[model samples]
Each structure stands twice: as C-alpha cells, then as structure tokens.
Target chain A: MNKRKSKNVFINGAISSEFIGQSIAKHQSKTTIGAHNIFLGQVRADEIDGKKVSAIEYTAHEDMASIKFHEIREETFSKFDLTCMHIYHSLGSVKAGEICLFVFVSSPRRKEVFSALEYVVEEIKAKIPVFGKEIFEDESHQWKVNS
Target chain B: MILHIKYFGLLAEVTGCNEETLEFSKNSVSDVLSILFEKYPDLKEKDFQVAQNNEIVSKEMVISEGEIALLPPFSGG
Candidate 1:
C-alpha cells in the first residue's frame, strides 16, 4: 500500500525565486540525500505573426489535475530510487521569463536524480491537462498547444 | 439523464461557457458529442478529447449520469 499523501501542486501565479530557494533550504535536515536535481520551466516570449507574447494565463480541471499529479508522483517513486520529489505549477497569469513550473527530485546518489528528474518532467508535460492562453502584447490571445 | 458538460481551454471560448447541463437520452460518448456539435458547430473544428467523469474515454465508451469535459491539447510544462 502507498502511504504517501496527496498534495496540492497548483500555485496562484508565477513561482518566485525566493520560494524555490526556501524549498531547497528545507532539505537540510535530510542528510541521507546526496544529490538534488531541479527543473524550472520558464515562460518564453515568442513572437507570433506580428504580435509578441506578453504572458500566459493557465487553467486546469482541478480535480483531474490533482489526481494526475498524485499518480505521477506515485509512479515516479516506484520507478526511481529517490528520497523525495516536489512539483509546482502556476494557475493564473505568468509573465514571460517567469517561472511557471518547478520539479525537484532528490536521491542518495547522482544517477537516480538525473534519470528521475527527466522522467518526472516528461510525464508532467505529456500527462497533465493544464491549458495555457498566450496573451499578446496588444491584448490578443491564442490557445497554446504542446509540441 | 441529466449530464453535466464542461468545456476547457479553447473549447470554452468556442462554446462561450465553461459548463452547462443537457438532458441526454443516449448512452455513448459519441451521442453526447453529436448534441454538442449541433449546438456549437465550431467545436467540430477544434481538436480535443473526451473525458468521462475525469478520465479520458473513447467515443464508443458508454456514459451515464456524470460530468463530462472536452479538453484540448495540453500545453502544460
């Protein structure tokens, strides 16, 4: 049986650098973890046609997203030798160059975290149901699709 | 049965609402979609998948009284 508790991974807006720093600081007590890998997804300012993207507004089916996150966490834990993992995503408007997604993984050795981090990030990109509306500088918007 | 239908992302913009209810008589996911396509013809042009009770399902899957969501291609990082 899985004893891990489900966590709310959604953040209100862009994730701040301070929050990321604090998260890393909180792991000091866990001396067994020798390696930590972090993945930060930043919003990119892309010019489409004649318009430039200013920000991305994100939304999701909260109930389904939560369930998917939990499943991803469980699957990652079972597949990798990891001490802990964390995932955070923005829900509201996130400006270009700001952090939108953060995934952190820690383990006893270097190799596990390297592979585990990639797996978790890729799984999130493919499995999560979150949507993004790319708002241009002129206020026009378009729906964003994963490539 | 009264089925609660939800539109997400671009689908919501096309449908002009996030959610609504329909008195559905049919049983399959395709039947519900036909009703939606008739009501919002633009939805037919959009690429999306059907989720029955929060799980993505095929058009042939039977659906009863529950929430259904139309989701576009995810862009989450």
Candidate 2:
C-alpha cells in the first residue's frame, strides 16, 4: 500500500516479553492477516579470552541508521506480499539472553512471511551502522563484529 | 575546507572524541585519512569504513561538502 511511513525503530533497552505479547494482541484486530512471522534476536553470552560476555551496549549513527532501516523496509515490501512489517532494535545496554532485535511480518499466507522475515533480518545485519560493545563479566569490553 | 567528522564504535574509542570539526586541505578522502592517521597512529591499525554525506565511500572519493563519518564494523542484530 506504500502507506508505511518511516518510524522510530529503536528502544532504549531490551524488548520485553510484555511488549511482544501486547504487539501480538494489537494485531488481533487485523483479520486480513492470516499468518505472522516473528524473529527475535537474543544476545549471546559469548566467551572470549577467558572472559564471558555480560551485556552489550549499542550505539548507532542515528540519522543514517534510520534512513537505512527505511530503505530496507521499502525494499522488503516491494519484494514480498506483506500486509505489514515492524522492526525494533535495542539501544543502550542489553544483558545476555535478553531480546535485542525483533522483526514481525504479516501476510495473508504463511509462506510469504517465512521468507520475508529472513530477508529483512539479513539486510539489517549487513547494512545498518549500529555498533555494539560487548561488556565482559570482569568489566572489560571488546567491540563486536558481524561476520 | 572545514569538515565535520564523526566517529563511532571502536573508531570513537581510538579517536577519543565522538565528533569534531577539522580543517583539512585535502582533495580526496584518503588524503584526509592520512592526516588523521598521523594525528592518531592507533587508528591506522584498526579496520573501519568512511561515510561522506551519510553514504559509505571509498578512500579515492573526492572530499566534498557534507559531514564525514568513520564507522567501525557493525554488530547490530
């Protein structure tokens, strides 16, 4: 429909289970949507050099990251038969095992969402200029790199 | 020309400032980078990308109008 305007996609901290539940509840009114696919990215407790990761502090070049997010949304909409889509990423510190990224896509059928969801998530991981500092349990930190 | 330069992630950690306006008499992005490397030798050992006017740019790109940013590898989910 092309009516999806650029929206703020960042939250100050982790995305709570309550928020996810409410989002699903809000979509109950959209009877036209038959299937919804969701992807939740959890921070891993990665260990490096005898240190365990405790949390991740996220930062972004906000203006550019927002613009990139909008482009990814537009591209996904054009490529898939999605009724609606939403993406949210965490800013600030998110503890390990907490949700940092959430992508929800709805369609009339199940198959469209299956592929569209992955596409959007992959594009974001590759393109967005968001950075993370992995804080170790001992208070030391290292930069995270996507590979 | 005076350019607004931004640093993010590891680049900011190395540069010690999030952003600053610098006077550079360079013709290309690489030329400006050389000056930065001279000022902060630690930066040369790390990997990063350059963005001009919010677009990722190569070192050969000409230095032109707009803000410049030095971005480290992205780790966003």
Clash count for candidate 1 is 0
Error of 1 at A106 (Å): 0.4
User: Among all windows of ten consecutive residues in candidate 2 chain A, which has the lowest summed lDDT?
Assistant: A1-10
Query: TM-score, each model?
Result: 0.99, 0.97
Residue pairs of candidate 2 with colliding backbone atoms? none
Candidate 1 regions exceeding 4 Å error are: none
- Candidate 2 lDDT over A14-82, as tens digits, reads 999999999889999999999999999999999898899999999999999999999999999999999
RMSD of 1: 0.6
Alpha carbon deviation, residue B3, candidate 2 (Å): 0.6
For model 1, what is the error of residue A117's alpha carbon versus the real structure, in angstroms, after optimal superposition?
Answer: 0.9
Q: For model 2, what is the error of residue A78's alpha carbon versus the real structure, in angstroms, after optimal superposition?
A: 0.4
Spell out the clash pairs found in candidate 1: none
- Model 2 accuracy (lDDT, Cα): 0.94
